[model samples]
Target: MADPVHKKTEPNGRYLIALSVAALGVVFGDIGTSPLYAVREAFGEHYGLALTEANVLGVLSLIFWSLIVVISLKYLTLVMRADNHGEGGIMALTALVMPSKLRRGHWRYLAVMLGLFGASLLYGDGMITPAISVLSAVEGLEVAAPRLEPFVIPVTVGILLALFLFQSRGTQRVGGLFGPVTLVWFSAIALLGLAQIVRNPYVLTALNPYHAVHFFTANGATGFWVLGSVFLVVTGGEALYADMGHFGRTPIRLTWFFVVLPALLLNYFGQGALLLANPAAVENPFYLMVPGWATYPMIALATAATIIASQAVISGSFSLTRQAMRLGFLPRMTVVQTSSQEIGQVYIPTINWILMFATVGLVLGFRSSSRLAAAYGVGVTTDMVFTTLLFAVVAWSLWKWPRWAVVLLTLGLLGVDLSFWAANIVKVPQGGWFPLVVGAVMLVVMTTWHQGRALLSSVLQKDAFPLERFLETLAASKNPPVRVPGTAVYLTRNADVVPPALLSNLRYNRAVHENVIVVSVETEEIPRVLGSLRAEVRALDLGFTRVVLHYGFMEHPNVPVALYDITELDLDPDDTYFVLGREIVLPEGKLGMPRWREQLFAVLQRNALPATAFFDLPPAQTFEVGHLVRL
Candidate 1:
């Protein structure tokens, strides 16, 4: 595959701010919204220990330091720099680490599996991010207006529905407001912190490593409880790296280091100070930081932050779907063009509708952010554990780093990640079960799809029509270009041979001869395949039958666009007809799926959106070839 080519868009000054703000609004939502419940939950009696000055400061300082090390140094500085093409994410990062020239098919399969696990966990995270963000923010109504207690769920639902509804119409209208608005949002947190900071300057003691060390050493068991909520502080840090491609790495890194990080830390310390001054108020230190008259506005601000957080996860979901589709981890989905002008503004109708429905269910089911927090940490930590494993591989096998360095680094990450994973296990009976269930279901569907595709590909390779033999078998027919009356291009699951459809087409309509083109789409381990590295054409039967090669995935595949480069078909665009094969399988003797799960696997594949729309291929020239292969 050709490496993703990044062309820097030279926007005017107004647009530059738009880029930054849009990045912040769209990208930072998940992290920005973390403040809503992170502090409160970490201090909540059920979730953690009693809040003391040392506890608050130590936790805040730890969060601040986590953001610095994880988001700033490890990812923004190191990982994002390893983007494949213009894309950044685990999958793209996977592609970048591929040996540029090697064709190790087995390794490719392993990478795809790892990518599926990472992507699957993200879907789980997506469900939780919205639930917790919205719930936490709306729960603020209790502090501002205690009369609003019972209305929180409805209010949260209304807010989430509004957010989902807005997704169909991309983030064009108010996108520019995100960065500057979040800037103000952070400043507000800082100012609120400043009030409490003045009362307990010693709250700054958390900044000392010794305080954090002492807290952990003196209160080991209690400190472990804090790890559950404290984990939320860095929940969205992964987005900083995964989303780096959407906004350039430089801008995202800048926004985090210069803007988001400082404000978050200051507000966190301020919340600690407030907790120190009034331990009883630690139950709601975030809201208590504001003046009485300002409570309503703070509630409103919290709502905006929730929306921002939901926006980030939603967009992250979109990007992940696109990557999965390209890498062949997922089925081709209907990629709806959201913006006529911006090529990147796309909405996957299936993903959007499904996530919206799931998110709404999560909000109503969990009802409160406090409840949803139990479900949130598990998926993120699971993903981090896998990431650490991958990083270890990269260090040892890919980067060839020292053995001890790799082992030590892996141990450090695994220890932290495993602890959080253990804590989240306690929440399984609570609402946390939702993401786990979602992930498990998705994993089955994806693994089934991937396994089915692989099986079908292998079968096609075995059942494939040999072009040489096929040409010889049917060559006696005249080159009556219009006798068959249309062109039938069969799509092959395997790249090595012609599809069964082409042979079936020839057998049914023996008058034969417009042209029979066998097309196969290969998902290379790399980004994209260049022209030179594309599919090869072998003409047979005096050029009446020809094979055409489609080069790559990243480039938008318009049949019309690719057809121009295909010299095999010396034919008119309007005259060229496309045919699709829709296979109907029976359990008699077809393939290798277990008898029990075969139908489940087949149903998922059948329900998947057509490959035509997914590849961005032309619509008018496409049709399906149905085969009820009794297995």
Candidate 2:
């Protein structure tokens, strides 16, 4: 195979812009769209009781403060630094601190469980995001025209269908428009709020910490309910870490601090002002913030922003699916690259179809954004809570920060996270069951796949020959004459020993080959290893030796790039012939785990692609030798 996987780079500036737009468009839009629903949900239905002026001010203050604490401080400023080899997201964070790759067996088992739980939480978020964002936006239609009330749910479904239909085309065409439009959308948010703040200048009092404390402490049992409301402000906060690779830590931080944070706070305070002036209109206060002349247009803009929010969650599901496949948490999935230059521009049809189905179910089942709002906070909040604990481990153990500082920060942060988590816990009987069910299914799938792989290692122990014996056999064969001058390699999965494929090839050909390389893919927890230590090529007699290929989880294994730099190979790409090993993944007659759970692994594996396909290696240059193991 010449090379299908080794991709060439496109112009840098263009890719950067597209990435930025996508990040802001669908990626960052979730939190941005919260102004549409978060306030009303907090006071009107799910948790809090009355939409009084004091409650409105208190809730608005909490949202603002939560944004400052969670998004601005915890994630944007802090958690981003813990990125492993430029890879962000919960999986990467876990790998950074949990020692997932280093420890095997039961320890490796638990780390995978925690990481998968976090990841499963994300998938649950993916299912809920499109439903809530689109429903909320379409509900604005009712606000603009009361007669459209009866058709809100149906209209939302149509819009969601149109959104997924557009996925195949990729975001390149419409993405450019997203940036300038998001810029306008954000400005309108601030400007509309500015007018309201001018009228009720006292609404600015919500910015003070005292209002937040007073609302929670002084206000009887109602204060406890604000926990559900608090979740709204922090909804899309996790996207900050998930999209870290798209726009380095610097840009996202800037976007959050300078652009996103300010626009959201002002708009929220404005909503508070509007509610204070006319408490009866609390049902659709976001729309009512504008004058009658601007109400319809504001609804239009809100609808557009909500669609972008849904798009982000859809795209994130694809990326997370791919990562899980790579780490062997999930099975290999067929991935189609939609854009030539953008690495993030991928579409998985299976994930897409499932998401569309579930989202449609969610839309119709809930009927309105208000109903869906009941289900939304629990997932996002739980995810944040998981991320918080992971960060605590990182600060003390991974980063080696001062213990006192880490302890104090962890307590303060976890307290807020736990408080929100506990309140959402009350929703378990309500809409919370949706995410819990999603999480349970995902956990079962991830756990079974991991355990089943370990059983493979145990069963194959007898079949796998020791590394020294195979090496000595090649040495013994050099007596006559070895065939081939350049390096002929065996792409072994384990570098610690010679692979059965290498031994088999020699026995069949009845000849010793020159420069036989046993290359194994070794993964590191901290991601990319420095280029200084590419390959440890040893000179063994008869040209048979070891060449271990090391890759940090942060970097992809590029065989061509790696081999080109090997001076012993004369730095020639064509001179080296590549061989890849394949194994039949089968269950032993004895049930390794439980029977039903083993079935779960089978389901996940059927959905996954082969290991070779994911590494971006060409098929022609690779050869497969099937080996069987009995337990």
Candidate 3:
């Protein structure tokens, strides 16, 4: 049977503009709101640096150039170009850099491991972004009305709970507001900064890199440690890269250069000017910069902007989890498409609740955004380092850059990444341990799941009979038994091996369906698989036919929907019987995996969304054949 053809269409100019505006809310939210707390944290009491003119200019210079080098030059110009079929992220980059044909090589294995770790670290970022962003914005209340300081934690907790609760309903309804609110936020911050910059225009001199160097030279070790706090300015850089698929390269780049970059630079310099004028304002320079009359209203807008920022990371977590599941690094969970119009908008209840609980806990435990800030940079910096490493591999192997150029470019980026990571490492004893712990736990879960699957496949392969050989045996059986009238579909991971479910059905029922199908679902590395390459169907000598369905990692696997697309097989929902092999993993008997890992895998497997649900199969028509596996 011939496959269907799907023509791709490019977005029109107006549509592209609309997407760019929408991208502002989702893509730039994290980085956009950094101005609220970044400068404040750098000059906070913990740093022990006097709020002198040199110090203020130095910090502002660091913030300026960090944004330029990390977000503008590296991410926008360099990392975003390594997208996999228009999709950008560590996972997508991993797929691009790791040689597809050489799956078992040492370099390929290491690259895949690093990529998974980087993706896992983002989960930590997701939790902290919401906690710190919301807390920092609400902290403005302390400056607005010092009397209301007592209600800060409670208010922050309430807002975060509401945010998480709203996730289930989907962001589509209020998503339209995200762009406008954020746009208002950028404009307001810009105007506020401009007012201050005009008062003390010399603060603009911080734009020079010399100020940053002199601050370090003057402060020495104390300045080096300040980079930990200074690193917070660019913490959202990874989100900008992770969310590239939502708006595409052009719109995201345009939004960053035209809107986000200018607003951020203006705000940072404005804060610096405020600090220089009133050193006492370092207590809360961001909120202090606003006029007394505008304080309450600015607080409201800052809260809205921070919530939008949190939403970006939350949505990012959902997207990352879905990608992990499709790539087989994580177990299946219930995924709801939040928007019929946008495939990227999704909600994972399990992840949402977990994040909410973690975020709220951070708020209550730390009690202030200042403390939470210590926990923030480690995950973001570690993720950046890994991204840089992976990008180097892509630049050399895939992009075919000259050896010298790749080395020079990669080493330069790596130097900046490592410096930031090193700066954050000093914060580990303070609060940075939080993300490291989170990343470690996630790494174990992902690696265990992947390893367990490999071991199970190996065990199954050892006892498996070839499909052709099994068909011959069944056909030549002395007693064919009763032949059922309806069609039977046996889902298998490996098409070359005889499915245990097929064997169990035949052995127990002593009957074979008049028409049978052996179907395998394959996930490709690309963002999407074209309809023309969706499925391959072949007829066997007997009543059996083999079907291999191809789905992109970005797509949800719907067996019923895919089956409908196979014209050669006229499938009826009521008549077809779906046979699935269900394994009960035992952690004993010397399985290749450790006992604890086996148990962990078993637990994850048990809670995993059932095959019927994941594949969107009709429960009434699906039957499971159970077996015990020692892996």
Candidate 4:
């Protein structure tokens, strides 16, 4: 079947330019803000690298090529092409490679685990990005006035607090400003670097790959270790692909290559020039490169940019949460539509508060951006590795590319990802374990939720009979219950199985609605389902109608809105009853997952948002019947 989401056409010229500018903020914020600290951290005292011209050149060379190869070549040119329909992200890519229905202990399980673990790692990234980015920006105070150094951490925590609090208000108001502000930021930083580069034009020579090679040849083990810090330059490269759905591929690539990449190169090389000219400036190369008078203004600008970066990551976490929930990897949570104008702008209070506390704690615990930097990179690098592996699967299995071609592409990209990952692994002892631990915990939660649901389906299936058989049996009954006037919609997971709510209602109230509808929502692998293919309707016997509503993983399942369009059912808002089943999980089962996992699953199930809210059912007319089931 032809996919509905992926379109070959590009946006019009005017829209393209606008999107590219918008992409500057959402897509490039994290990587764009890296200039505040990437160079400073690379040459920090922690790496033990000297402030010599050759070392400066070498680091610049590595940073430049990393942006070129990883971001420009790998992500934009290749990985972005592996997008699931028009959507791209580790989770979307995972959905692309995943089987329509996952079977327990399947061979493709390895890919599923890799993709999920990668997606899980982003949560860690979400937590750390805000802490490090904001702290790094605020730390510029030390350069402006040495006296203000003591207040940096407190200021950072305060800023993060305000940012999280503002999430409830949504981004529609501030979102327009992000692009223009970020554009100004990029232009200002570019000019700053240009001024420095003109003074020491030789730093531009680091553009040659030989300097990167020579740095490794000279520093040996220490140079290799320095990559952990250098990797920071391209840390947000994945955002380009992840946000591709919001902005098209052309706009993201256009923004990256034309705007973001040049600005980054100039700034990084300019920082290298500053370091070469004045070794003492290594303490804070990014801010030191700024004019003494512009220091405070620059600090504010950097802070704004970092805040934008943090916003993108936080928003991404919310988006990933929604996708995970739709894909059955997560339990449903309350998702607030933050903007009436934008469907993508959603706010999840649960996610926002959790991230807020974690980010604030990180700022307090680390006390400095440099320390927080040590805890970063591992999760992102590992996620990159998983993305590459999943991309390989897409190339080979989905796209039907030759095995040899896939192998070459995978090997080349994996080399860069694995090397960075190995460099980052050394940081595990120095607080890098934070993201790993977070990813592990998340993986446990996600896998447990998925497995538990599977088991629940199995048990429910055992008790359910075919819809046709149930209808025929009811019709054959000696005395059928009196038909009710209102239309009844019973929501269930399987259309073939009898709805538990229907069973409970019949066993107790002993009455069937005159018009009965069994509705099952199916989340498709693609990002969206077109209106033409949204619903599949089948008329059954004895006043029974089976309706299956199809939604993409990226979409929210709104039962009432979808059912309203059917026309034939003539669903009424006032008279219709939306019957839902509430499963009360009993974790004391000998079969299925371990007892501990079952307990966790039970807790997750119990806390999940009600179907009435998640499916957009009218609460006034919605009612849930409870059923107990062993895991």
Compared with the true structure, all predictions reach lDDT values of 0.70, 0.73, 0.88, 0.90
TM-score of model number 3: 0.97
Candidate 4 TM-score, true structure as reference: 0.98
lDDT of 2 by residue, 1-631 (tens): 1111222232246665555554576547888888888777777654546767667778877888889888889888888877766778988886765563333466544555666788887888888888988788777777778898888888888988998888888887776677667767888998888888899989887878877787887776668776786788888888889888767766677667777888988888988888888886688778878788887787778778878777788889888776665565666666878877776778888889988888899988877777777687787777887787777676776577898998899889889888888877777776888887888888777667767766765555557776767667645754644476665667776766667776667667665456677777665554456676656776665566677776654445666667668877663455666666555545454645776776665555555665556655556666666665433
What candidate 4 gets wrong by more than 4 Å, as runs, is 1-8, 100-105
RMSD of candidate 2 to true structure, Å: 4.8
Count of backbone clashes for each model?
A: 16, 5, 0, 0
TM-score of model 2 (CA atoms):
0.87
Q: For residues 281-352, what per-residue lDDT tens digits would candidate 1 score against the true structure?
A: 776778888899998888888888778778778877876776677666677777766666655567777788
Q: Sort the predicted structures by TM-score, highest score first.
A: 4, 3, 1, 2
TM values, all candidates: 0.90, 0.87, 0.97, 0.98
Model 4 CA lDDT for position 91: 93
Q: Please report the candidate that would top TM-score against the real structure.
A: 4
lDDT tens readout by residue for model 4, 1-631: 3455535467878999998889888999999999988898888787788878889999999998898889989999999998777898999989987863334446468899999999998999999999999999999998899999899988999999999999999999989999999999999899999989999999989989999999999999999999999999999988888998899899998888788888888898888888888999888888999998999999999999999999999999999999999999999999999999887899999999999999999888989888888899899999999999888888877788899999998999999999999999999988899999999999999999998898888889888888898888899999898899989999999987789999999999999999999999999888888887888999888778999998989888888999999888887788888999999988787446778898899899999999999999988898999988866
In model 3, state the lDDT of residue 312: 89
Q: What is the Å distance of residue 459 in model 2 from its true position? A: 3.2
Quality of model 2 by C-alpha lDDT:
0.73
Give me the overall lDDT of model 1: 0.70
Model 2: lowest-lDDT 10 consecutive positions: 1-10
